[model samples]
Target: MIAIPVETDNGTPMSTKLFGNAKFFALVEPKSKDYTIIPNEGCGNGIQTANYLLEQGASSALYGFLGDGPFHVMVRGGMNVYWLGKETMPLDQAIDTALSETLVHVTTENASLYLDPGTAAGACECGCSHD
Candidate 1:
């Protein structure tokens, strides 16, 4: 299954929020176009979302942004994550784009390019609570 982090409860549109900051996740089956939106347990905790997605049985993800913490956690857990670069598209198009493999596959070596420093490693400049 593919996990797409979304902001709306309906899960129709994708979120610009960093992966772990999304309010909900749309778990979809690319082939059947079936999806379910579930509350994100990790919420604003960047690193925790990695395991959360895994527990949800997400094998891959397509997100607008990611942080180094979750990047490493997801990668090490054997999940493939793609960077959808500035594309705040709807869930359907996002899934299509991912299926087309048009987005860049993120890796530790180049994670910084797509990683949101503010949210990376649970580092928040806004003095927010993550715990």
Candidate 2:
């Protein structure tokens, strides 16, 4: 299963909203996992978030427009990226579209982290840092 590290206004996962302006850094296979959210930093930029995921054993990411810096780091780290969805769709449907291949032009950008048997630094330093 895909582990999505979403940015939330509330302290709830189902209630949480994926930070629209936030940069998604990693798409992790839930099986190999450990993570931390860096707190009080606005939503994480694509690069920092991505790096955090890399530190946490992520091999891929599913998100939208990424700036050059974060885009580059993801490539260097070996993460597979597929850009999809508009702000209109809810997160679950968006993810579903991606899986079903019904989504088009969703992946405006693409990159990879290139690491094998990825490693995670635990959420303490990354995702959990946000709390």
Candidate 3:
């Protein structure tokens, strides 16, 4: 399952920022196209959110932005993170895009805490160099 942070529970567009503060997350089963919205019980707590996702069987996550701590925790916990940029599209569309592999796959080798497209131009803090 993949989790996409959303601003509302009724299939509204996903939030463009503040993954830790999102009100809801749409859990999607890619193969079956089944989805459900769950309250973000870990709101404001990145680690808690990561753990919650893992507990709920999420193997990956799609978000517009994520903090350094939570990103690291999620990656370490075996969840792949995909960046959806700043676009605010419906959760279902996001899911479809992810399934199609159109999102930027955030990895420790290339991830930056900041989302500025022109600013991610150096060795990642996780110690991987792009050179």
lDDT of 3: 0.74
Task: Tell me the tens digit of each residue's lDDT in model 2 across 1-131.
Answer: 33244443234322122322453322423443433333323354444555665676656555543444444555567765545532434444544555665433212242222111111431122222221
lDDT of candidate 3 over 92-115, digit per residue (tens): 778789899988888877775443
Which runs of model 1 end up more than 4 angstroms from their true locations? 118-131
Give the candidate number with the greatest lDDT: 1
lDDT of 1 by residue, 55-109 (tens): 9999998777665667777888899988876657787787788788788888877
Largest TM-score belongs to which candidate?
A: 1
Q: lDDT of each structure?
A: 0.76, 0.41, 0.74
Q: What is the TM-score of each candidate against the true structure?
A: 0.83, 0.49, 0.81
Candidate 1: Cα lDDT at 87: 52
- How are the candidates ranked when ordered by TM-score, highest leading? 1, 3, 2
Provide the RMSD of all predictions against the true structure, rounded to 1 decimal: 4.1, 11.1, 5.4
Report the poorest 10 consecutive residues by lDDT, candidate 3: 122-131
Cα lDDT of candidate 2 equals 0.41
Report residue 113 deviation for candidate 1 (angstroms): 2.8
